[model samples]
Target chain A: MATKDILSPLPGTFYRKPSPDAAPYKNEGDVVKKGDVIGLIEVMKSFHEVQSDADGTIASFVAENEEPVMAGQPLITLNI
Target chain B: MTRKVNTLFIANRGEIAVRIIRAAKELRLKTVQAHSVADTESLAVKLADVAVNIGSPAASKSYLNVEAVVAAAVASGADAVHPGYGFLAENARFAEAVEAAGLIFVGPTPHQIRMMGDKVSALEAAIAAGVPTVPGSRGRVETPEDAAKVVELTGFPVMIKASAGGGGRGIRVANSRDEFDRLMPQASAEALAAFGDGGLYIEKFVASARHVEVQVLGDGYDVVHFFERECSLQRRRQKVWEEAPAAMLPEDVRARLCQSAVNLAKAVNYRGAGTIEYLYDETTRDFYFLEMNTRIQVEHPVTEMITGFDLVREMIRIAMGERLRMRQSDIVMRGHAIECRINAEDPAKGFMPAPGTIESLTIPGGAGVRFDTLLYQGYTVPPFYDSLLGKLIVWDENRDAALDRMQRALKELTIGGLKTTKPLHLALAADPDVRAARFDTQFLEAWLEHRAAMLEDH
Candidate 1:
């Protein structure tokens, strides 16, 4: 097994769901594909999607939802 | 009889917070800065007589948290709360909360805030006050049949607006009868989904209009006008530049427009500093009341420059239960003043907000020029708030001179390690149409599109 970490590209509040009422884009033990949105980073009142760069499966999110995140901080870990 | 405000609490952040602190200090009132965790080192916090961390960085947990803000104000022993421009400035419930907690809300009464805060009610009040309003439905158009009736009177092009919508949101314009029928239902559904209100209103769509607003101050008994501001230059319905004593407004029309604003404020027995916004049709030379902001606005400094009055100080005094201090004739508009909103966004890249540490800062200064900012060397602008880094305001004897001064000041401002909208303002200052004072509400977005295409060719 190979492990990799997805890093946040911006410094802001990270959200796992598209909106407050919506389900999270990804969860632990969920399979993900490249270019799949896993979270959103809200910066300066604007939202940007954080996409997975590689195919992975069944890992864990390092950064919690609605928490402040910094650029280059690890947001999720994946097993390939 | 007036209750003096010995301590003032600022329940907002950014340049406005700093602006309030300065005004309070000038009045010899203690300033307590209520800030989020992310703004611990903000210039406002640094400059205040005291500081309190209300909650986390997200505004929902701090600035907009009515309970938290009110508790913080009480705990800080602050007698009055200034909500600034955003956050809870217009939230009537928040104003009520502050007052219920034995503290003064530095704005109008909650009833007045609620009245002006609603689109439908605000329009009704405008009509009742004898202020000219856009020809449309009397109140919320409940159904398509009712909307059709309004369109009959409003003509071909009409606007379908959500009574709960604001900041240019939840609006659909129909240019023809067919378009109106098709869009009316969709707009209603969207408004319900967005604002939980299916209520809608109709208004005559002014094809070529300018965004002119009159500044008024009231003490719950009397109201006075500070002339008008032209904020037609906007991007995404957000004002980018503002000028006081709207350029080329016929003196007679200006007088009528200003008096109308005072009429509305008196109707509400309005307190504190407020702005009565209007849509002015330059071709017809007719003006209609748009809405009233029951709080101090972002472009207030331009009015201050043209008329040497400290609006912030006046609002604080009004909050302390003081009566109207100045008469209508005492306030005079002397010169042309312009204000450019400097945001921490990249102008070339669709205004992508860039939040970073300020490595160096070169502030513009001289006679009749002021840069109101919450920035300092080594300050890290948090990515949590609006992109407004500061406002660069300039004043001169005439419009032409003010424009020249704005160009010079924009050139002198420099911020390191951050992308800003400085380039955008520079281009606007150089543009011939802008210099000639020829633009309407829809001008800047179209101008931005044209500028983007030009940039792509290069």
Candidate 2:
């Protein structure tokens, strides 16, 4: 299996859940198709969605939920 | 309200953080820096006695998080919090939060901030205190017709300003009836986008005015002014170079300007450090109250250099409820001081921000030169905040000497990686008008245009 890393496009707080009351968009080991949002990056009080580019199963999340991330930092590792 | 502040928590970052930490160290106080995770390796964190991670790097969850900052102060056993120039520095809610957590907020009270934060209210307050203000709309003007009424009364060439705005974000000048009609809606749109307030007000536009500000320190009732600083050399209304003991202000005019500032401070029963900005029409020798900044300003170092007083330290003392130690008569401006705001932005290519790592750094030193900065060799300039990399300030026996030192200092100072306004500062230092002190608030835009045109011809 080939592992691909999903990198953040912006530097800010990484969020896995869509909202506080909702569950995370994806969990480790969950199968995600192309265009599926894996996490969100919050910068300057705005949220930007980080979507997967290829269909794969999530191997692991490199950045923890609510963790601060830099541009191009790995957010999730996917097994393609 | 005098409370002992042993452990001080710094609730901001960048040069101001470094500034506060140094002041606290001098005062023999333990310091804690509440930083975002991204700024863990910042210079301020390195110098602080303790560092606490408040939240993620996003300012909303970290520096601007009133609750997180208050919690960090209490959790770190900090007795006081210094909200530096930006972030939550002017936030009244943050001040209340710090006080609610039983810690001293090192600035003005929440009420004073609330009163002055809104431009319309500040104008009304200034008038109540007998401070001279530009004639303008008595209230918020939303429509062009209402703005026309104000423009008609104030006469031709009036300024439309945002009711809730600062830092020169929401301002437009109209010279004629057609211009006024076109600018009224344009100014309102910018005001709404910048301040979340579409409300506008028109004021009599005093042409070719100098931007001068007076530094004032107050403890409830007693207030004192630290002379004035001429900040007329600006670009897009951004102050680039500032000098103190305003050049060529008549003796009586200086007295009246300083006195009016004191009167305003007394009117507000202001506390801590503040600056009263004025637009001086050099041609007429008349000055109008522009606005009052409730927090310690970025350009405070110029005033300090001339007055020989540590404004930040004095602010901390004032927050501790101590009476102002100096009287108006006791304070006298000495010599001359000028400050250059060194930003990590290029003058050409439309002043684009160039954030990167500094591979090498050279800071100028010697008598009469001071550099206040957080830049260290190999340190990365983060893109999340202000472009101000540092401020190079110099003091001398007179303006010419100070200008000469600044030019030399500018030549000696270097940051290896980023494109800075250094080149522009050098050119302005040698510009004929700048050297002769012949400029106003409207000077820089035209200067830059002329400089660019000259460059093209070459």
Candidate 3:
């Protein structure tokens, strides 16, 4: 079966790193476990951590850091 | 720094934006409206001097987009921006951007917004001003152990509140240490999801308290209270019915309540119209400062009706650097006024948002009646914004007369397309305790639950 990609559950600004000048939580080709925080999404001054529900190797990052993203948009492609 | 505001851009939608446009027109200021895809044909857009499409229907891409709104203002040559409640109304960053663009931000300064936006800090300011606030932690606590210690000091039945929370989100009641332990993580998670800050604070929970608030106006230096409003009729911490000159308040208690509101506003050097909310325990006859809404409140019209003052007009004038036209002694409470928020929700179905086209519309009218709505016969109530479709307000010689008028108005009003809170208002009007003015914050919820159970019983 093909690996499932992680998606943003809410509409907000996507952030690859927790804060400016910090390394991203996950990157391409990195193996991630279920519930591992992959990125952050901020909506109306609120930030929600986007987690990978399925453990898999990261295929690609669908959205750039600090860019606006919509609900149900793909954040990352994964290879189980 | 007093600049003449000839044109104002309203960066919002719904009844509030319409309210602002009407006030601007009264002031002879040209109005520019910014709309998202959801509000292309909204009443505010249709009524403005010019309407500019900002972006998509989603708030993040449209209404809340500060750059888009500012761009629209610049393009339309608007000298000032009126962010009519919600969206970017309290957004400090957006306010700063408006100032940087050389456009007036028709609210408090950025510093004031940031300082008052955080609940913990605002509470600290209230305490420093000697305002009576519920005793609790001075700042946000990080761990369960910290929360427990704070709870112990504040005693049992404490409320865990998110520092960055509002609109009834990110709040949990902890009856004991075990409950605190069970709810802390959930509260933090919800807070982090709702507000960017997961910081939590504890406060003594005052059960069965009346939600009384004092309205104040300021021009940066001078501040005055326009008296108080009782908003005890609420569901899930959201107010439904609000009336001015809160009934059952002693003369001394009322004076103290209004004075405390003025003291806090002066301490902050507040500007424009704001509401200082308080929790009044009728049993103890004591009041505690809850929080200050640094923008025009949704129920401001009730206070306006009784005081014979136009609050929105005052906000615009204050933004233009005009001094308050009236003083404390000049302000007089003329009559009783009550406002009922008409929301597009099904009260029987758990207050679920009922968004659809209005197939038919008939607003109530008569003596001492006013309906501030944006709904037309074919108007489609979009699910993008708040559920409040309009406000039905009435005024009379006394509270009883006002209540009777409200009941009649509710009966005359009709929106055939979708379910609304009209039935709920009807039930509230018929409740004995509510009619007698003995109800508190929990009255509406309890009454609704009882009604639902009775419906099930039948």
Candidate 4:
């Protein structure tokens, strides 16, 4: 088994849920496919969705929900 | 007389924080700049007499955190807290908390904030003050059938809005009877899911209306108007460009429009700086009250430039219990002024946020041109907040000259290392329609669409 990391493409506040009270797009151990949204990055008051580039199961979330992250920082680790 | 404020704590950031610090210093008030972990190197912090680290970089943990902000203000021994424009500026609970902690909240009372913050009550207050409001349901329309009856009189194209919504959220525009019925339930469900309150209201959508607002100052007893500013040039409901003394506003209409704002302010016994927004229909020469902003607006500089008044200073003085020294007659409008909001965005690529370090900065200057910004050489614009880098304001004796001055100023301005809305402003300054003052609230989106299409063809 091998693990791959999904890095943030932009610097901003990362949100696991689409909105404040909504359920997160994916949880740890959940299987995800390419193009599936894993989280959202809110920059300068605008939101950008973070899609998984490779199909895998989410091994762990490297960036906590509602935490500030920089561009190129690891957001989640996937077991491919 | 109320106790004088000697120390002012700015519980906000960006250019507005710097703007407040300058006003506080002029008033001889010691300034305390509140910053998040990320904004330690910001220009506001650099200029303030003292700086207080409130919390982390996220706004929710810092600027918008009411408890953290109040505690910091109290600990800093600040006599007054200035919530500049956004964040906790209009939050009634925040105002109450600041006052409870024995610090003056440099704006309206908590009651006024809460009243104007609510859509239905604010409309009721406007009607009570004899202000002309858009023709719609008197209050909340709880049922679709009730909405139908109201729309019969006002006719097609009505807006269904959530009572607790702001920032253009929880809104739906229904064009006809069928559309109204179709959207009502869906809109209600969306509002409920989003805001936790399903309460909804309706207003007749004013197509092709210009966004004009009157700037007002009050001392809890006496109120005065600084005339009007036309901000019809908006993108996605956010004002992009603003000008004072709305273009082509007939003298009689201007008089009425300004008077209506004063009436509303006086009715609420409003204190400090506020803006009364209106939707003006050029075709009928009728202006309807949109809502009231209980704090200073981002576009306040345009009004200040035309009137030759320091609005921020006056607001600070008013907060210290000083009476408005100047009367309405003394606040004469001398010239036309324009403001273009320069944002850290790529206008060509759908105004996408482009946050990067300012490798270099060349601020435009030369008489009548003012650039209020937080950008400095080597400063990195954080992605945690708004994209607004600064506002480029220009004033001249007349509208034509002001437009020309704006063009000159935009050309002189330069900010290296990131794409900005500067190009958009440059294009707008040269536009024939913009120069002719032929536009409405909906004009910019259409113009941008056409411009994009033209770019594609080329």
DockQ of each: 0.87, 0.15, 0.06, 0.84
lDDT of 3 by residue, A13-62 (tens): 68999988999999899999999999988653456799899989998998
Clashes of each: 0, 0, 2, 0
lDDT, candidate 1, B247-300, per-residue tens? 969999999999999999998899999999999999889899889999999999
Which portions of model 4 miss their true places by more than 4 Å?
Answer: B140-203, B453-458
Candidates by TM-score, descending order: 1, 4, 2, 3
Docking class of 3: incorrect
The Cα error of candidate 2 at residue B80, in Å, is 0.9
> Model 2 in CAPRI terms: which quality?
incorrect
- Interface RMSDs of the predictions, in order, are 0.5, 4.6, 6.6, 0.6
Models 1 onward score TM values of: 0.93, 0.80, 0.78, 0.91
Task: Please give, for residues B35-59, the per-residue lDDT of candidate 4 as tens digits.
Answer: 9998999999999999999999989
Candidate 2 chain B, run of 10 with poorest lDDT: B449-458
Query: Over the stretch B58-151, how does candidate 3's per-residue lDDT look in tens digits?
Result: 6878999989999889889999999888899999999999999999999999888888898778988999899998878877898878877888
Q: What is the DockQ of candidate 4?
A: 0.84
lDDT of residue B86 for candidate 1: 85
Give the true-contact fraction for every prediction, in order.
0.77, 0.12, 0.00, 0.88
Greater-DockQ candidate between 3 and 4? 4
DockQ of 3: 0.06
Ranking by DockQ: 1, 4, 2, 3
Better of 1 and 4 by DockQ: 1
